[model samples]
Structure formats: structure tokens, C-alpha cells
Target: SDKPNTIETDDSRLDRIEEMITNPNERIRTLENIIINQKPDILNLKIKNRVHERKFWRVSQILGRSSQTMATKVVGSYANDLKNSKIQEKHEVLVKKKRLLEGSMVTTPVPTQKAVTAFYAYMSKSENIPGTHHTLIFDTAITNENNGYHPFSGIFIAPEKGIYVFSFSIRLECHSYGPYELVKNSQVVGVVFSDIRQVCLQDQITGTMVITANKGDDIYVRTHATTSHIGLIPSDDNGRSSFAGWLILN
Candidate 1:
């Protein structure tokens, strides 16, 4: 007789499937545990990113300061180089003049005999600020006996060949310095310097010189090429700048 096959019923099959599948509550619990375990690692990653950002900014700031320092040094060096170049150029000009003198090409002016007792002129005011090598106008003439001194041009045009004595005073305002030279025929013969060291302090500097002058020779005061940007040094009621001259021989 054939053994009766064990009948596979639907209820038995369903019972086996239920055993194989996990419960929904157990799956939810497993997901929760996985998220909880990874939370600290996520927080550590965020913290590390912030630290890296801070370090990058710090390094950038340091580099910025270094670049600024380098730029300052470069600018200062360039300015110094320019100053040296000017000095060298001035030296070259002096050497050339010295060479010309050594060649005996220049002749001395003959001294004039005594003629006029004195051709005297004096001025009290500086009309305007003069530029480099520009004549300073003495607009207000106190006395011009021989009329050799011209207030409009600030020049003493020699009425006749003679030896002349010239004097000048320069007074600058507070916090100012003005250095001017006595010029004869486009040559600097003397210098007068004035400086106000303290604020609100003002003073005057004066110079005197005697020189042989040819007829129609121009004599005046002028500023140096290195004068301040203000150009003309101003004089107020605090002090006065003056110019005076007298012919010693004519």
C-alpha cells in the first residue's frame, strides 16, 4: 500500500512565512539604534570642518600682513633711491663747473673806481611768494635814492659798474622754514635761512654780501629748488622780510 503523502495545508504555509518575516516594531527599533550610534560621529565631522575654516582664515590674515610689510619696504627703498640719484646728479654738475674753472675760460670782472658816494635803496614788504629761482618782489619801497633798485622786479640793476653791499632778511610764519639765496646774474652769492621750530613761533634770518657788479647786472633774492610746496614763504605782522642795498663804489 502507498504511504499517504503528508498534506501541505495553507494554514501551515502561512505559519512558516510569518516565522520567516521580522516584526515591524523590531525593524523600527533597529533603525533607531543605528541613528543613535552615528550621531556623535556626525557632530565630530561638523566640529572638524569649523576648525579647518578658522585655521584657513588665520593663515590668510598672516599672509596679508606679510604682504603689507613687504610693500612698505619696497616703497621706502624706492624713495631713498630717488634721493640718492638726485645727489649724484648734483655732484656731476659741480664737477663739470669745476672742470670749466680749471680750464681758465672764465675771466674776472674788473673793479670799478669810486664814483657815486652811495646808491641806497630799501624795501619793507614781500609782495608775493616766489617760485624756485624766481625773484622775490619787494613791492613796498621805503627809500630808493639812486633809483637803481626796482620794487616791481625785486632786482637792483646796477646804474653803473660798481661794488655793492646787499642785505636781506627772511621771516617765515609758524611751523615753516624758508631758505633763500642772494643771486647776482643768475648766480647764488649768499644764503639767508629762517625756521620756526615750534608752532606759533616765528622769526627772521638775515644775510649780507658785497660784490662787484657790472652795469645792468641783476641782483635779487630767490628761493632754492628744494623749497617747500607752499612755494612762497609768507610774512605777517609778527615779523617783516626786508631787502636793502647800497653801492660802495661806482
Candidate 2:
């Protein structure tokens, strides 16, 4: 009886041990299954997060481009406004000057005889020379009052303050080219050029301008410094090359 009781106790303890081990093994298998079933959901969540991040960056880039475009438009509008303001200011100044001149003309008396008016000149001979800033001499005089035009020096001294109409004509000889400028008080006022490189005989160029002059202002034509070739064709009777001017208003 004592042996049987000991054997029964040992069997009970072994049964308890086996139950504990089996229970833990079943729990572990269930947990592993749960984790395996959730793998697709976890991957989906990660993909969604990456897509949202890309969309955020794309929206940020669009907003940045829009901001830059708006800034450029603002700058352009401001520049246009500034240019218009400057133009308006210039127009207002010119209007004021015109009004002042009109008032002065009303107070001034009209003279019976005009001021020093008649002056004209022309070149009579052909010339072919290369020079820098060389003055052109006009040997033929059509009408010169008060000896205002000096033929030797190729300069015209204004006799009185007035508005004058000036004209110049230049003829280039065959295979030659010349560029000339009309100068007033050492300032360039107009330009004339002639090129006979492609022509069989000659090529002519003419320029004219109306300018206001002060007394003693030096006016003349000179060969341009940048011109490569120099030759002028002139005829005494044909007046192919000439420089002439006359007073128009006082």
C-alpha cells in the first residue's frame, strides 16, 4: 500500500509538468500566426506614409514656384510704373518751358529786318584722303552774310542766336567709303555716310537737321574717325558734295 501511494503521487506531478509545457507551446504558435497575418497591413501603412511624404514635397515645390512668379510680376510692375513716372515728369517740364517761351515772345517786339540770315557753302573739288576728325572745307559759297563761314578752316561761326536749317551731302568715289558727322560746338549733331564699294560710279548720302544756335557757336562737318576709307566726289556745277545752312527763325 505504501509503494502504490508513492507511485500515484509521482504520476500526478508528471501530468502537471506536461500540461504546463503544452499550454505554453500552444500560446506561442497562436502569437506567431497573429504576427504573420498582420504583415500585409504593416507594409500598406508604410507605403501610405511614403506616398504622403512625396505629395507634401510636390505641393511645397508648387507653392515655391508660385511665390517666385508673383515676386517677378511685382518687380516688373514696379519698373513699368517708375518708367511711366519719369516720362510724365519730362513731359511736364517741356510743357512748362513752352509756356514760358510763349510769354516771352508776347512781350518782345518784332524787328523789321531779320538778323544775320543768309549763309550757304559747298565743296567744289574732289578729295580723296584718309584722316581722323578732319574738317571738310567748302570752297564754293552760294550766299554768306557777315563772313560767318570760313572756307580755309572749314568752320561756320554763328553770327546771331537763331534757329537754323542745315543740310549736308556727300558723294563717295568709286571703290571708296566715307562717313562724316555734323558737329555743333564740338558736339555731334548729325551724320552722313557714303559707300561706293558695290557701285560702278559713286554713292551719295545726305542729312539735314534744324537746330537752335547761339552766337559764336562753331558748326562744321568732319570725317568720322572710325571710317576705314576716305574719298569724296564733288563737282562745281553738279553740287554732288556740299554743306549749307541758313537762319530760319530768331
Candidate 3:
């Protein structure tokens, strides 16, 4: 019995050994296959980590750009508000200045003249009356307003441009005869004859005329050209030689 048991045990052990030898390194090969199957998972994990890092970096860049943009907008809004406030202050100042100017005096143009050519003149002496176109001078200006009639020069210069009325009276002794003419700008305007012949014996004659005179025209009284004028013009008690003029708008 002991012999049989020992032979059976040896056979069984030999058979088991032979089976293990035939399928060599089975456990080690199974472990190697499992490691190979897990290779894709490991690679995927590494790729996921890289993607998360890139996503984190992109989010950080966006936040930095957003912060800078927000700061710039704030500064721009503040600048705009300051500029608008300054403009409003300037407008208010301008309005105040305008009000002050309105309260001040409204300045006007300088004054002007309306009357200048009203005058009268007369001779204050007895004068001999005989000449050829002799200018008779009235040395005294009674009412020479603007002195348009120069009493010394015996010339009435028109003070303003318009029509003017002029008149003159001349005296002569009896039997003295001559034609006195009012000369205007080298032209005879009118005539008055004072011939105190024995027929009428007039002491004086008067001449009146109207003329459109410029501002600087000349007017005077004179004897007619080369006429027989011989007399003493007695101006003391007999009569007076007078010249007067006034203006009328044309």
C-alpha cells in the first residue's frame, strides 16, 4: 500500500510539471497584455492635461485684456465729463459779458452840421462909385452866420452845395449914373441901373438873384463893363450898400 501511494503521487506531480512547461510564462504574458491595453488611456490623460493648461492660459489672457479695456473706458468717460464742464463754464462767462455790454451805453456816430450858409454883410463907409467891373466890398458882416460872405474880399462863397438867394443894394448921388451887376463865377447874374438923371433922381437901386451854387463858388457886386459910373456913394444918412444871402436845398 505505501509503495502504490508514493508512485501515484510522483506521477501526479510529474504530470503537473509537464503541463506548466508546455505553456511557458502565461502569467507574465497576461500582465504584459494588460499594460499594453492601458497605453491609450495614459496618452489620453496626458492630452487632457495639456488641453486644460491651454484653456487656463487663454482664460487668463482674456481677463487681463478685459481689465485693461475697462480701465481705458473709465478714463475716457472722465475726460469727456471734464471737457464738457469746461465748455459749460465758458458759455456762462460769455453770457455774462454779453449782459454787461447790453447794460452799457450804445455808442453812436459823431455829430453832424445842418446849417452853414446864412449870412448878411454891408459897407460902413462912403465910397466913390465909378469903375469898369469894379468889385464893391462890404467891410462889415452884420449877420455872417458861417461867414460864407467874406466881407473883406467882397466875395460870397457858397458854404454848401445848393440853390442860394442873394441880394444887394447900392446908393449913388444925384446925376450919378451906372449899371451895377451881380457877378457870379465870372458870369453876370443880374443888373440894377442907378441913373439919378434929372428925370427921376433915384438915390439907390437894388438887385436880387437866385443861383445854384456849389460849395466853393464866387459871388460879388461890380460896376457894369466900362460904363459911365461917376458918383460918391453916401452911406452915412442917405442909404447903405448891403449884400445878403441864404441857402435853399436843391
Candidate 4:
């Protein structure tokens, strides 16, 4: 009986060992099936990652192009502005130079054939009455070309279109007062004042102008309306009052 019981126990142990081996083989097969089922999901995740990477690369390329376009526009605008500024500066310089040329006082050449010159001096006390425009009559003529100056009318007519230099001087005796105007074609171009109210004996005034005159224009010296009595101080030498002019250029 002891021998039989020992053999039964040995057979049961072998059966248990075989059952353990079978269970382990079944579990390994289930694990393999699970790995096989997860392969599609892994493949789908890889595809999504690739698509995301492509989209990111495309966005980067578009942003780079946009940045370049903006930079180009900025550069172009700056260049245009700089060019316009330089042009404006040049225009201003030209305008300034033109103004300076116009205002310059350089003398110009005069033609010999059409020479216009005149000089006259007053020898007597010729009075300018009140409320009347008095034209200063110069009696003694030092030089007169073509008789352009009328001593009787105290008017000098321009013989040609040209620039001219004109000058005049007057001496006032006691109690004399006047305002003198150099008239050009009925328009006043220059003025001189002689007032001996503060002074006890006399006063003197002089006027000079550079003018542009057209042909047939009349130039003269006349007394203002408010003047009571304006006259040249009587002198034997005719040196107290004088008028002179000369042509500068055509």
C-alpha cells in the first residue's frame, strides 16, 4: 500500500507541471495578439505627426516671404523720400541765387550812340507856393545830351528803356520847409525832406536812386502839397541846388 501511494503522488506532480506549461503558452499567445492589434494606431499617430511637421514648414516659408516683402516696401519708400528731399533742396538754392542776382548792384554797360546824360543847377531862389505842386526848375545846364531834360518843366524824359542813376540836392534858407518827391511817370519813387524850423539859418537835403525806366517815361522832382515855401538858397555860383542823371544799361 505505501508503494502505490507514492506512485500516485508522483503522477499528480507531473500533471501539475504540464498544466503550468499549457497556461504559460496560452498567455504568450494573448500578448502577441494585443501587440498585433496596436500596430494600426501607432501607424495613424506617425501619419498625424508627419502632417503637423509639413504644416509647420509651410507656415515658416510663408512668414519668411511676408517679412521680405515688408522690408522691400520700407526700403523703397525711404529711397523715394530721400530723392524728393534732394530735389526740393536744389530748387530752393536756385531760387535764392536768382533773388541775389536780381538785387545785385553791379554796374552795366551803356551804348555810346544812345548815350543819355544830364546835369543841371539852380541859380535863383525859385519858390514853391502852398497848395500847388512845384516842379524844380534848374536854370544852368552843365551837360545835356539830346535835351532829354526840360529845364522849364523840370522833367526828364527817358529816351530808351534802361537803368539809370539819378541824384538831387537842395539847400533851404531861413524859415523854409518842404517835402520833396522824385516822381517817375506820375508815381513817387524817392523823397527828401528839408525843414529849418529847429535850425536858425538853413538846412540841406539830398536824394539818390537807381531806377529802371521805359522809353517815354517822365521823371521829375516836385514839392509836396503841405509845403508853405520851398526854394533853393540864392547863390551866384548855382551850387546850392542841383539835379543829375545818367543812363546805366539797356
| lDDT for 42 (candidate 3) | 93
Q: By TM-score, how accurate is candidate 3?
A: 0.53
Sort by TM-score, best first: 3, 2, 4, 1
For candidate 1, the per-residue lDDT at 191 reads: 84
Weakest lDDT window of 10 consecutive positions for candidate 4: 123-132
User: What is the lDDT, from 0 to 100, of the residue 17 in candidate 2?
Assistant: 99
As a whole number from 0 to 100, the lDDT of residue 109 in candidate 1 is 50
**True lDDT of residue 153, candidate 1:** 77
Worst 10 residues of 2 by lDDT: 230-239
TM-score of each: 0.47, 0.52, 0.53, 0.49
Going through the candidates in the order shown, the clash numbers are 0, 0, 0, 0
Give the per-residue lDDT of model 2 (tens digit) for 36-105: 9999999999999999999999998998999899989999999999999999999999999999899888
Cα TM-score of candidate 4: 0.49
Question: What tens-digit string does per-residue lDDT give for candidate 1 at 25-90?
Answer: 678889999999999999999999999999999998998899899889999999999999999999
lDDT of 4 by residue, 99-175 (tens): 77765633443435755455565535544443336777766676777677877777889887888889888767777
Instruction: Report the C-alpha displacement of residue 222, candidate 3, in angstroms.
Output: 0.4
Ranking by lDDT: 3, 2, 4, 1
